[model samples]
Target: MSLARIYRGGLPSSKFIDVALGQGARLLIRRSSDRGIRGLMGRQSERRWIRMGHNLIQAGKAKRGRGMHTSGETDMQGKAKRGRGWAIALSVLAAAAVLGFGGYHLWLHRDVRVYVNGVPVDIRYRSSFGEICDEAGVVPEAGDLYSIAGNLIATGGGGPFTVSLDGVELSEAQLDAVEVEGGESFTVRDGDDAVEDSEVVERITAPRLVPAERLAAVTYVSQWGANGIDRVRVGAVSGEEILEEVVQEPRDCVLASVNPVPSDGRRLVCLTFDDGPSPYTAQVLQILEEKGACATFFVLGSNVGPWSDAIQGLEAAGCEVMSHTMNHRNHYATTSDETYRETADAFAALRDCAGVYTSVIRPPYGNWNEHCWISSRGTMSASVIWNVDSRDWELPGADAIVENCTSGIENGDIILLHDGGGDRSQDIEALPRIIDILREQGFELVTLSELMDADDRIPDEAARQYAPMPEDCAWPAQIAE
Candidate 1:
């Protein structure tokens, strides 16, 4: 059969054909039988007669036909070749279908969507409910349930809310909620004049008590004897009953010992430095040591390893070495467990390097929240915060540092200063003068733990008072020492 006369469909399904044509006045015909000519002519009778008369120079069939000749075996080979091509295409398509299905399944099941307060969140990865909530800016609530498509993913229970999700329950402290209450109508005072006749007063309270019990409890009992004085007893109680009576003494002020109220005696200041072990820290320590003053150094774990000698010197000089976390990351912006792990790692590193077990922690960037408490619960540490901040990190001059620090000196104040981070040259430069000024102003520089010793630094009580505040007021504006 001629190349033009070849029909692919009539070939056996298993055969594949390979055809090549050249530019020449020649024709080759191939068929399976002597009657092949009749079959080919019958299929296209009009074309067959014209083709045969036009190409009559070469008319014999051979194994390799080049001219007008007919061969049956060559026609069969072409049909088989065409069939094989179809089989190969089908095989390739089958492989592609398998890969496509596999990729689709991987994409569909790779990530999960998280929701907060009925709003869908783009988590895009498998992570704990606490992590998702942090990303969504949803402060976890005690007893709050986290679910995905009606299936519980985590449960909270302790800090402020108990979350339930995927059969796991995690307790987190809830954020403060704004509550509006009816009160006596008041007028707005603008420059001593009432601008509006009536003003609605709004009060914001912290979220309902976390599932965890208060760190301390208080009760008032009246004494009927000689002085007719009423005595207030503050106790550390468990959910079931009182664990220990904290203070049984009589006080003139009922709110006096209820909170960690600093005494109005001679000014007692706790100096706390974070991110330490820099070269400037040694100078700061030298000043503190010369003044016989002890301060709390919240050193980063990574800095400790490289500055072991410096850390040892600080400790030897009577400075308290505490944990500032393994990495100075924002605690409030991280997961509960991750925060816990970082804090734990810092503590572990301190213990390994400094041979000290410190229970004081200053969260990085001073970023703390209910989650920090939850993360630090049972970690044998108290969150130490500053009542006065010198803002030494601002690169203010030594005179400014002295002025800022001395400006807020008060009895039982915790002053925050930085010794690590970047250029603390200002801090080092200001330390001696600041110490002398504080002493001149009747302020005693002591470590945070020592300052807390004036009034017991109970973990629960400290946790409640150390709760997160707004970013604007996150760090105290002034320092006492």
Candidate 2:
């Protein structure tokens, strides 16, 4: 701390501090206040800052280090310089720490914390409860209990088949409905409820057509009615309408198949014969060939032995062959294993005899369940149903069958008939006449495959396979009905 040594470098106190800290060698080159380089942000305020930095550095160093005692005056000067330098260093360090702490909070600790199913997880922003659940991979399964915010959505799957969303059950929509802030915590329950208590919000009505006398070629959907589908949780429900001893809800009661089955944009009608390939199989093909038309035969597996060639000929003559099961038994009365064999055996026969496999299986009596679909998973694509029922099996005679078929034949109509069972001679007698009537009306007879693409299958309207509202469900009315 000698006066002679202090004046040795002729460097200002601030520059001396910078040198000592290795600023030129880039050691502590972070701060701008001492350098006279970052001129106080867009102005020459660095001139005043430099003067202040020199004074501060000198005093800071004096307070922290031994001063030169070469003389009384020199010792005092050295002390002042040391004190100033120490104060400047301390101030810079404190400012840096505060800035760094603030930066850390802004960058890393911004996410909202939420507990889903009792596990802590963070979401980086304000999110609704539903979005968080999805993020947490806890989507609601049908029958799983649900709650929105703090409101419980009550479903009656009860005890064994229940799921408890411990507390907050914010489905996606519900989450969107609320303002969930970041850093807030909410509890989501077990989320494994078996009976879903979802509100049946809309009613999608059956589609129908109206014949416009004035307009012969074009048609339009007459009444745009809404259908009401309720999400019901039932382990095994059996009633006249829906006799399914089942699980899971049907996507929609086949009350409405694809809005327009023949989405192919063609003027086509499907001539489908179920329980067929009978003694008069040749005659049906003859009529179809005569009219230059095609047809689909849903042949019973048992009948495949007697009428294998007719089945091949049906495919050969530009027709599609499908399944009618081994025996057309009531789907509800049969076991899952029984239904599996019924569908599998039919598929095997068609494949063995005709050298072709088809995915369409008209579940015996056009019935289905979660098990039916599960059993025939890969084998069946659709269960073909008829819009026009000939009911020729009722043996109501030729005229009645023809009347039933031709009365309401329109685009995408499936005309059901029998070619095999019983006196199919009635169907034989009615086939040519029906073909003639359809052609005279400017209809194009095509196979089920050609008439419409995809699993354009629907259940019988009489099947009435719909879930009853849960006895303990507290959902609002879907569509007044």
Candidate 3:
């Protein structure tokens, strides 16, 4: 056969040589290649391989001229040439096998290298990009960058690695594939290309509540309610951002109702100002407002017409405005008929002058005797009498007034201070001081109704009726036992 035909299809010359030598030669070549024949060969052995190759080429030429020989001569020459050709072919085959085996062994143990953030990491196995990083102790993060390799292996986080080859961006499939070559480098750096996207999310916020002890089934919104917002950023790494805005901070709404008991279980006190709607009344209201306190104002009926705004201010300031009898009439000196007239007229004047209606009354000089009680049976809920008196009507100094009001004060005690009937400058000065002192002592200064309701003193029948003696109610002439 022609040499070109033998070498067709790019099959190695040794392959044909093995076929000519039969199966035994093929197996020998394979075994030698598997065991690494190069490790056994020296320079002299290499020189012998070169000589064998030259003889094999010459044998090919001799075979091409074989037809020119005479028949008898051809037989004799053919046997000798064939024997020599076989020897040369076997030598060449052996050298080629050893060389091929060496090349394959070198390929199996080839190193894959990459630079990780300026550090060199060497990987021995042909694993996926992610596995190679693991083997080399390299973990690329979300904000980290990767490039220079067309086929990038994913990190431990399993990603389509941001990859480029020769400055050209690669497809997602190539970026995610397991491909690494020796001496290839990639850097893990602070990259600006980390995908950053945002979404707005709304969250419902519950309104805060502050419970106030009261008899009414009502809720007062001291502050309005609103929802809250937050912004979330999504990327290689997830994070939450709390935006600073003009957010209306939630405030507590005073929820007034009958509770089982106080959370602190502390008894409350009622601060009552008698004969008010006075010149100092506004000052006292301002002090109460500043101190965040509530009190009861027992207004004189005669003063209501002249100081109608002051009386209304008392109600507006969350203070309970009640009656202190018309013209400050002494209940003890008045006859039963006169006592009824005084009590009923004062309530009528309060309702007329200031639209004020309350069930509590402070008897003139707290003198609610049988005559007064019999005359004003249904007109009042309770005769609020003070146990702790500031005696500021005597024009005591502000210090003395504060001392007298705060001392000997017990829970459930009613404190008395007049805002009118005299110069109440001391009373006004002492009001805020007394408030702070009482708060420090942990006494909640409530109105008369709140204190009585807390003590369960208001009868269920009286509680059922609205304040100011509902117009439909009839007064009994007999005294209550």
Best by TM-score: 3
Worst 10 residues of 2 by lDDT: 215-224
Task: Give candidate 3's root-mean-square deviation (CA, Å).
Answer: 21.1
TM-score for candidate 2, please give it.
Answer: 0.42
Candidate 1 versus the native: TM-score? 0.43
- Please list all clashing residue pairs in model 3, or write none if there are none: 129-153
Tell me the lDDT of candidate 3: 0.61
Per-model TM values vs. the true structure: 0.43, 0.42, 0.43
* lDDT (tens digit, per residue) of candidate 3 on 323-407: 8888888777878778877878888898888898765567777676434655664565445566777888888799999999888
Name the top lDDT candidate.
3
lDDT, each prediction: 0.53, 0.57, 0.61
Error (Å) of candidate 2 at residue 8 is: 99
- Estimate, for each residue in 1-481, the C-alpha lDDT of model 1 and write its tens digit: 3444443453322111122111111122232222433343233543433343233212212212542254677666754664565455445544543454445445534555554545666654434444555666765334423221222333441224334433344233321221112111111111211111222222221121132222211111111101112222222221122113222222211111122333435457777889987888878887887888888788998787888888888888887787788889887688877887887787778778867676557778767644465455345335555667798888889898888888956677677789989988888888888888888888777766555545543333333212222232111111112
Off by over 4 Å in 1: 1-264, 456-481
For model 1, give the RMSD to the true fold: 31.0
Q: Count clashing residue pairs in model 3.
A: 1
For model 2, the local distance difference test gives 0.57
Candidate 1 worst ten-residue window by lDDT: 218-227
Could you give candidate 2's per-residue lDDT for residues 406-475 as a string of tens digits?
Answer: 9967677778887777778888888888888888887778776554442234223111111122233222
Instruction: Order the candidates by lDDT, highest first.
Output: 3, 2, 1
Off by over 4 Å in 3: 1-264, 460-474
